[model samples]
Target: MTAPRKARSALDLATVVLSLMVGALGIWTILAGPTELLPIHYNAAGQADDWGSRELLGGGLAGLALLTLLLGGGMALAAGRTDDPARRRALRYAQLVVVLSIPLISLLIASASLSGATDISGALPVALMSLVILLIGAFLGRVGPNPFVGVRTPWAYKSRLSWERSNRLAGRLFFVIGLAGLLTAPFAPQPLGLYAIVGAIVLAAVWSGVESWRVWRTDPDRQPF
Candidate 1:
């Protein structure tokens, strides 16, 4: 098989394997995990603030595993339907992100619950989310006009220049913010670090939307609304 075909097969296999692994873990948790209430929520100081049953935790893992499969399937379908090489690549990358994230989150939760941990550090989740943001930013600029992903504004849809420029700008902002968040997560105050990252993402999104409109207004080939 060709290199691209091999790569696609590998990704497909990985998606299936990850889904099965998470699903099996969920089943195991349900069958053998602690029967008592488990800490389901944590405060900024890593103290347990809420509790839940093993079923809730196991069900969540199962749900996430199912979501991963659904997202992977949807991305594959979208890729198959699109002829644009750039769009297909972007879809593939998005699928990869979903595959990596769902399993990672499931395992993290499972580990915490099974280990009878009362409190979980907030830094890890923040760092992981930052890493995800960085990964998405690394590819955002390459994504072609698509409804499924990447800063989809109406202006961006009407103008290719708007799409490209706005996504590139957003990409840069996300990359920088993500890097800063990742670096500071371990040192910054718990909730503050999370709040700052979320706030920055929102601001970047607003800025990118405005940029799309600004560029679309000047784009010679922009489609009329």
Candidate 2:
């Protein structure tokens, strides 16, 4: 088989394996975890403010795994049907991100829940999410115009130039934010790091949206909606 085909197959296999592992972890947690109430929500200080049964946490993980599987399958199907090689690659990249992220999130949550820690650290989750943002940024510019991924602003949909420039700008911003967050997470105060990441993401999104509009307004080839 060709290199791309091989790579696609590998990704598909990885997605299935990872999903299964996450599902298994959820099952294990359900079977072996504490039967009493567990921390289900945390404050900015990373202190558990809300409580729930272990079954809730385990079931959530299982649901996440199922969702990941469905999303991966959908993306793979879309990639297979796409005529453009670039768009197909973009879909695959998106699929890779989904495959990697859901499992990481699940593992982190599971670890915290199973540990029975009332006060967990936010640094790790922030760092992991930062890594995910960085990965997305690395690929956003190359995603091409697709209904399923990237910054899908109306202006971006109308203008290819808008899509390219806005996504590239967003990508750069997210990459920088992710890098900064990853580096500062350990040192930043509780909840502050989380706030910073959320704020940065919002800023990036708003900026990208404005950029798309601006570029679309000036694009001679922009399509009328």
Q: Candidates' TM-scores?
A: 0.78, 0.86
Question: Compared with the true structure, what per-residue lDDT tens digits does model 1 show for residues 1-225?
Answer: 399778888888888889989988888778887899987766555567778888888888888888888887788778778888777887787677667667876776677767777655477767876887787677676666666567799999999899999989988998898899889988988777777887899999999999999999999999999
Candidates in order have lDDT scores of 0.81, 0.83
RMSD of 2: 2.4
Query: Which pairs clash in model 2?
Result: none
Question: The CA-based lDDT of model 2 is what?
Answer: 0.83
lDDT of candidate 2 over 87-106, digit per residue (tens): 79878987886786777777
After TM-score superposition, the amount by which residue 65's alpha carbon in candidate 1 deviates from its true location, in angstroms, is 1.3
Off by over 4 Å in 2: 120-123
Q: By TM-score, who's the top model here?
A: 2
